[model samples]
Target: MKYFTIFASRNDTNDMEAVIREVYTGKHSIEKTGHDYTVTRKSLFNRWRIMLRVLSEDTNLDYFESNIPGMMGFYDHIPFADEHRKKLVLTQISALNTMIAIEAEKELGDEPFRLCKELLSKIGGIGFLQDGTLLDYDGQVIVYPDGSSGPADFHPRACTRKIRGEEIESEEGERRRQASIHELRERGIPYLDTLPQLPPVSECRWKSQEEIARRAVALLIVIQYACDAANGGELDESKAFVMGLLSKYGVEDQLTEDERRLLSEEQPDPQEAVNIAWQYEAYWPLIWALQLTDSLDFPDRICDSSYAIEAVSKWGSFEELYRQTALRSREDILDAADKTYRLHWACVNSRIQGQDAPAGMIESIVMERRRGLFWMVGCGMEDWDHIPMDT
Candidate 1:
């Protein structure tokens, strides 16, 4: 009896059948097409979008999974399937704001080692990846001269969630903090059950600019309390509160001892800070948008056109105006952002296409006037069907 290796057969149509059987039933359902929905990249994309939408409905994971690929981690963590789950996690979650790293020593063996090494190399700072043992979220790592780490070193007050209605609020208020922490522990099992392990800040870039701004906004919490005490009944009105928030986020340069003392000293006025909060709220979306497009150097460098749309629309408070200005055809890339953005793009495109612009004018005019141009510019894109050069 001669037993042959069927896998060595010239016609390998069987591989597709195996993929259909294994991958189809695994995550994505077998659709009317009678195949795994994620077989094609396009199909996988569709499935990913569906999963993202479903995940979005769950408010708790909003802080947990934003910019992080929540479901994709499940596939990578399957022990038999892949061991380089850390690297995969880093790649998927690196670009997004809001990263979390879990410690995996006894249970997560080898995974933590790879995660720590990558984090240390990519992002080096004071508490980013505490001794490559613990994970820090921001670019800053908290390293003491004595070599100790944890909340003690950097002391990040995480956003514990409180259920008020369908939405969740941060655990700033004392009463809310206690209630939220309890609810989080009870309801958070699903959110955390399948994580491979949390890598450090160096492991991945967590905390989008929006999240950072929000944390900085926490400094306002202190400011509000201080102002209430100072005013007695009136408002202790000043730029100190706003300045303190920016200083806390490290957006501003060096501060005087007076400013630092003030921030450390007292609480802010709630009513005054309440009015100020709207500006910070508006700033958050723009900050997030800036971080999103932070990678782009020249307008020509922007390869991902979808992000270009978002950068224009939500970068500022007036979402509708941007939406109208940026209303381009589905396939159109150039006309999707703002017209001022379009002008900057034209300059870049002009450079890339070897067209002549005023000397050094493109460089000066392109990115600088984006904020100003964004406000006044209108998008009256005439030709939507034409795909811009190289796009």
Candidate 2:
């Protein structure tokens, strides 16, 4: 399934409603996994809404790791305005999307309408389980006796009636919640409300979801191919499809002339070449996250790629050179790269402040770079225009 579909079907209330009908009657107007206009547009708008909601809630989503599902933390940032106001904004935006979806239904088909309503239902259905009582759809909890674990404890004829009908009594819910709290406390797990407050984003690096998805697609294809080749398996047919895409983007021809030539002399397989390329691509975020956490587990190849000489010969600037070099995994090379980066950044900062970069500072930085061993630094370029950018 497409990434957006998974998110949409699971989170969008309208989308859920559409599916529930299909589930009940075993009838559908459209097929799943087909790249139809309705599916594609719904997926697009779902992603759009998610991004906007993130921005509206946290305002700093561009900086640091946005607390998006499957991206980072489950909480990105607190809502910017009052919670009610945020909800109002989200509702208004969603309603507008519903209107657009209605128009799409008229032109495209009922499938769009079904998808929109179901997706909307999915979003609306989300709720917090308050206190310690897990409520049913009717908001009533079937309580158990002290020793029983089955619903037999709530047999209409056998159990003592505390409060009948829907909605767990507030007192009962509190009592159950306290019991759960006590148990968790004994195990040393923090309560949800008492957990550490998320700090503001300190660095902005991640771009739009589309950009991330494009990178992800490239990296996933390369890695999947690598795993297949690493196990002495034949090349996957999907490699050809990805290759075609690369060709359309003008990247395939470049790779064939340059990267392919280099790989032929080293890693003989085309799949391996792609894998290596993706390895280079995947390293960027790992390094960035590590830096923010002040934890290092990888080598810094951001300045040690063998392509550096050829790339520089081709008039590649420092940033391009660095991004290319960031692809390899040699320990000595990564150390040197990190040192170079540290020195370069330091020099830039010194110049910015009208201070002379200290004499032999670069040498000291180079020496200190040797201290990192067995580190698996990630690969990628820092935005040069943004000084003091995240790793």
lDDT of each: 0.30, 0.30
In the range 100-216, model 1's lDDT, one tens digit per residue, is: 122321232343233333333233211222323223333332322233322322332212221111122222222323432343345321122222221211222233333333322
Judge candidate 1 against the unseen true structure and give its global Cα lDDT, from 0 to 1. Answer: 0.30
TM-score of each: 0.18, 0.22
Q: What's the C-alpha lDDT at position 170 in model 2? A: 41
Residue runs of model 2 more than 4 Å from their true location after superposition: 1-28, 31-79, 83-115, 122-271, 277-301, 305-391
- Candidate 1 stretches with Cα past 4 Å from truth are 1-69, 96-233, 236-391
What lDDT is reached at residue 369 by model 2? Answer: 35
Q: What does candidate 2's lDDT look like per residue over 1-391, in tens digits?
A: 1111111112123343454344223233333332122223334333211110111111232222112211111111232223333232222222111111122322323444344334434343211122212111222332221211222112221012111112222443344345544644464433322111111112112233223223323333344445544555444454565455444433333232333443234244655454354443233332322231123322222333243123223422323323432322233333333333433333433443456544334322222232221122222232211122211
True-structure RMSD, every candidate: 25.7, 20.5
